[model samples]
Target: MDLLATQQCIKISQEIGWTEKRTIETTYEMKLFNDYLLVKKEKFPVTSIFDISFRKKSQTNDIGFLYLHTNSGVRTYFIKEEPFSLIEAYEKLKLERPELR
Candidate 1:
């Protein structure tokens, strides 16, 4: 798959804590490929992606979430930066190749 774009994001790993809820996060480069979305070795096909949405950062959360709703299930990626560019690119690719859908 050809690389279209890349976004820097965090991948969250939660742990139960007594004092407060805790999460371990790792930075990952999310690659937007011509035919798939790849992050941390997991790949999701562009055709399976049904929609994209943003879960805004709130008081409790420090970062926003980029949601990829796919035919199989939803994949959430944590991000501190704006995802408008990524969404725009994804939409454009999907539109350019409707046969993938």
Candidate 2:
């Protein structure tokens, strides 16, 4: 599988302690392949993937949710920033290589 694009997602750990001001941020990669989407370690095949969506971080929302809708189920991943690049790349991949989908 050819790597098409990758999105960096940051998850800040919440802490409630005076000893540590803040916990270290965790990093995760959302990768788009020729026929699959890999979120960290788990991989979802393109054929099973139905749609991908995102929600911006707001006062109510801590970190936005990157919703991956698939045949199995909807998986939500916390993302610190907007994943416009990943979305664009995926769309382009679909346009350029329809067979991959």
Candidate 3:
């Protein structure tokens, strides 16, 4: 996993309601173990993750967001700059998680 990108994801998790202090201190990898997408500050548990979608760019010069559809609602993550890392992670999940495929 890209440490920098994963760290960015953790930071965003904190901004978006991740309150677990212990988790924040832990090193993260984009590993889909069991049913959760394990990250540093938060775990996207499959139970809570309803779907995953990619948004179209709002403008030609702009990138778009990766939409994490959850039980609560869709959470948008800025991923347009270099999205392949997260895409690979999700693809791994899809391969391992038959239901998601």
- Candidate achieving the largest lDDT: 1
Instruction: List candidate 2 segments past 4 Å from native.
Output: 12-24, 57-62, 97-101
The order by descending lDDT is 1, 2, 3
User: What's the lDDT for residue 8 in model 1?
Assistant: 79
Q: Tell me each candidate's RMSD, in Å, in order.
A: 3.5, 3.5, 9.2
Which is the leading candidate under TM-score?
A: 1
Query: Model 3: which ten-residue window has the lowest total lDDT?
Result: 2-11
Q: Tell me the tens digit of each residue's lDDT in model 2 across 42-83.
A: 878787877778997665436787888888899888787787
- Candidate 3 overall lDDT versus native: 0.54
Segments of candidate 1 deviating more than 4 angstroms: 13-24, 58-61
Name the regions of candidate 3 deviating beyond 4 angstroms.
1-34, 38-40, 56-63, 99-101
Arrange candidates, best TM-score first. Answer: 1, 2, 3
Model 3, 40-90: lDDT tens digits are: 457777667766667656564454566677777887665434455556666
lDDT of 1 by residue, 1-57 (tens): 678878879877888878887879888888888889888788888878888788776
Tell me each candidate's TM-score: 0.76, 0.74, 0.46
